[model samples]
Target: NKGIGGFMMIKNFKASEKIGDIVARFPKAAEVFKIYNIDFCCGGDRPLSQAIEEQKLNQKEILERLEEQYGTLRSMELEDVDFRKLSMTELIDHILNTHHVFVKTELPRISDLITKILRVHSVEHGQTLSQVHKLFGSLRMEMEQHLIKEEEILFPKIKEYEQNPSDQLLAEIISVMEETENEHDGAGDLIKSLRTVTNDFNAPSNSCASFVLTYKRLEEFESDLFQHIHLENNILFPRIKA
Candidate 1:
C-alpha cells in the first residue's frame, strides 16, 4: 500500500500533459522545470514525455520532483496570481501593465549596461561581449515591436471581440496570435543565444562592479521574460483559442 501510494503521488504529473499546461496550472513548477533545463515557454507546446526523453532526463525523478514541488508550493501563498482565473481583459491588462512595462523599462537599462561593459571589458572579453550586445540589440527590437503590436493591434481586437464575440473577430484574433507566437519564438531564440554567449550570465572572477551587474541584470531579464512569455503562450493564447 505504501509503495503504491508513493507511485501514485509521482504519477500525478502525467507524462502526456503539455509542459506549458503544467506550468500554467502549477506556476511554481516553472522554477523546478528551469532547474532541470526544461522549456516551459516558447518550446512548451509539446508533451512532458518528449522533453524528458530529448533532454535524457530520468522520467521518474523529474515527475517526483515536480510532484513534490507542486505539493509543497500549492499549500503556500505564492506571489504569482492564479492567471487561469483572470478574465481575458484582466489577463491582457496584467500582461500589458506587468510584462510589457518591464520590457520597456529594462531594455534600455540593460542596453546601456551592456554597452558600458563592452566598452570597458572589450579588450579582455571582446568576443563574448560583442555577441551579447548584438543579441540584446536584436531582442530589444523584437520586444519593442512585439509590445506595440499587442498593445495597438491584437489587444484591442481581443477586447473588442470580448465585448462583441464574433466569429470574424475570433479569426482575426487567432491570426494575430499566431504571428505574435512566432515573434515570441524569434525573441526566445535570441535570448537563448545571449545565454550561450554569456555562458549562462556567468561573469569572470576579475570582473568589476558594472561587469558583474550587467550579468546579473541579464539573468534577471531572462527570468522575467520567461514568465512573461509563459503567461502569453500558455495562459492567454490557449484561453483565446479555446
Candidate 2:
C-alpha cells in the first residue's frame, strides 16, 4: 500500500468529483477510493475536488485522472493538513453509521428476497438464483460472524489500545484484523457475483416489486460493503499499525 503521501490525486474534477454520491459516476476511481477506505458509492456526496482537499493531498502533484476519455482533466488541492494524523475513532464512526447500518438493515431483507425469488424463479432461472442464494447465505452468515468479531473481540481491543498502547493487545487485534480482511475479500467477491447473477439487478420485464427491491437492495448493500472494508482495511488498520 502507498504511504498516505503516495496516494493518487484526483483527476478531472468532474469525473472524480462524485466522491460521495453515486458509485456509477466514478467507477474507475472507485478502486482508488477503495484503496483509501474512502466511500465514493453510498456516501459519495462530496465532490472529488473537495475530497482531495479534505485529505490534505498535494493538489499540484496529482497526475491527470486516468480515463478512456482522453484529455479531459483537472487539478485540485486543499489547505495543508495530513490525513495520516486523523483519529481512527472518527473513521470508525463513519463505518458504523454507513456500512454497519447497511448490513444490519439490508442483509436480512436480501436474504428474504433471495429465498422468495428462489421459490418463484428457480424453475426457469434456477442456476443463477441458486448461486445467488448460496452467496446471499454465505455473505449473511459470514458478515454476522465478522460483525461479532469486530464488536466483541476487535473494537474493544482497539479501544483498549487507544487508552493504553500495549504491544500485546495490538498484536492480537492485528491477528484478528488479518482474518477479518480475508472475509472482506470473500464478501466483496460474492457481491460482484450477485450483481452478475441478477443481471446488474435489472429485473425482468414482468418482475414484481419484491424482485426489483431485491436487486436494488443488493446493489446498495454491495456499495455499503466497499465503503466498510475500505475504512477498516485502508484507514483503521493503518492508524492502529502506526
Candidate 3:
C-alpha cells in the first residue's frame, strides 16, 4: 500500500506540464533539472515529459526525485519575493539591486578574465576565447544600453502608470516594453551563440585558471540573464497588463 501510494504521487506529474511552471513552483526541481543539464529558463515552455524524453532519462526516477524535492519550494519562491506580489516600484528596485547589480559586478570582471584567457589559451582553444570575448562584449554593451533605457524611461513610466493609470500612459508603456522585449531577445540570442561557440561552457582539459573562471562566469551570466528576463517578460509585464 505504501509503494502504491508513492506511485500515485509520482503519477500526478504529467508529461504535458510546462518545465518553467515546474521550476517556478518547485524550486528544488530547478536544481534537479540542472543536474540533468536541462534548461529550465529559455526553453522552459517545453513539456516535462518531452524534456525527460529528450534527455532519455527515467521518468519514474525523475518523478520520485521531484516528489522528494517538492517540500519548501513554495517557501523559497516566497523568500525570493515572488514578482507577482510586488508593487511596480518594488519590482524595479529588486531588478536593479539583484539582477542589474550582479551583471554590473560580474561582467567587467569576467570580461577581463576572458581577455586573459584569450592571451593565454587561444592557441589550444583555436580562437574560442576570442569569440567568447567578442560575443560577451557585445552582450555587455547591449545590456548596458538596455538597462539604462529601463532605468531612465520604461520603468519610470511603469511606475508612473501605477500611480496614475492612464490609457495613454499604458499604451506608451506597452510600446516601449515591447522594444525592451526585443532587446531581451537579442541578448538571449547572443548568450545562445556564446554557449554554442564555447561548446556549452565546458572548459578544455588542462585549462588554466582564467579559462575555468571565464567559463564559470559565463554560465553564471546566462543563468542570471534568464532569470532577469523571466521576471520582466513573464511575471511583471503580464501583471501590469492585467
Candidate 4:
C-alpha cells in the first residue's frame, strides 16, 4: 500500500469508492479520468463503478490505468506537501492566494482578447464567437460574485469556526457552502457551454494570431478553473463537513 504521512493510498482502486474522494487523495488520477471523459468536478459525487457503467466504459481498464498511473507518478507528485494534511485555514489561504488571484488576473485579459477576435473575425466566425462572448460574460459575472462570497462571507466564517467552533457557525458554514456549490454548478455549466461553442477551444486554420491566442487563453482558464473547483468541492468542503 502507498503511504504518505500515514495516509494510505487506495491499493485496489475499488469501484465502491467515490470519484471525488479518489481525486482528492490522488490528484494525478484526474488526468486519467479526463482521458476517460470522466466528470470529476460537478459529477464527482458518484461512485467509480456507477460512473463507468453509466458512461459505458470498461471498469477494469480504468481501474488498472488509475493504479498504474498512481504507482508511476506517486513519488513525483505525492512527495510535495499533501493538500489533505493541511489545516483548514491553510487550505483556505492557499485557495485564496492561488486560484482567486489567477481568476482575477485572467478574466479581464481573456475578455478583451475574446472581444478583439470577435471584432476582427466576426464575418466568418460570427455565430460561434458571439456565443463564446455571451457565455464568457455570464461566466465572468458568476465567478466575480462567487469569489466575493468565498472571500467575504464563507471563508471568514470558516476561519471563525476554526477559532471557536459552534453548532451555529457550522450550520452557517454549511448553508454558505451549499449556496456556493450551486454557484459552482452554474459556473461549470457555463464553462461547458463555452467549450461546446468554441469547439473545445480549437481555433480555425486561417485564424489570426489574436484569435488563436484567445482560444489558448480560454483553454488555460478552463484548466485552472477545474483545479480550483476540484480543490473546493472535493477536498476543502469534505474536510469541513467531516
Per-prediction TM-score: 0.68, 0.63, 0.66, 0.67
What RMSD does each model have against the real structure? 16.4, 13.1, 15.7, 16.6
Candidate-wise lDDT, in order? 0.80, 0.65, 0.76, 0.81
Count of backbone clashes for each model? Answer: 0, 7, 0, 0
lDDT of 3 by residue, 160-213 (tens): 998889999999999899999999999999999999998899988888777876
Expressed as tens digits, the lDDT of each residue in 101-206 for candidate 1 is 4466578888999999999989999999999999999999999899889888999999898889999999999999999999999989999898888888999898
Candidate 4 lDDT at 16 equals 87
Whose TM-score is higher: candidate 1's or candidate 2's?
1
Model 4 TM-score, 2 decimals: 0.67
- Once fitted onto the true fold, the runs of candidate 3 whose alpha carbons sit more than 4 angstroms away are 1-80
- For candidate 2, give the lDDT of residue 212: 75
Superposed model 2: Cα runs more than 4 Å off: 1-86
Considering summed lDDT, which 10 consecutive residues are worst modelled in model 4? 1-10
Pairs of colliding residues, candidate 1: none
State the lDDT of candidate 4 residue by residue for 1-242, as single tens digits.
Answer: 32432223434367888898777645567888999989989888999899999999998899999877655532332356677887888788667654675576678888999999889888999999999999999999999999989988999999999899999999999999999999999998998888888888899998888888788778777876887898899999997899
Among the numbered candidates, top lDDT falls to 4
Q: lDDT at 11 for candidate 2?
A: 30
lDDT of 2 by residue, 3-107 (tens): 112222213334354565324322344555665556665667776666667777643433233232212211111224333465665455445433564476567
Flag regions of model 4 displaced more than 4 Å. Answer: 1-79
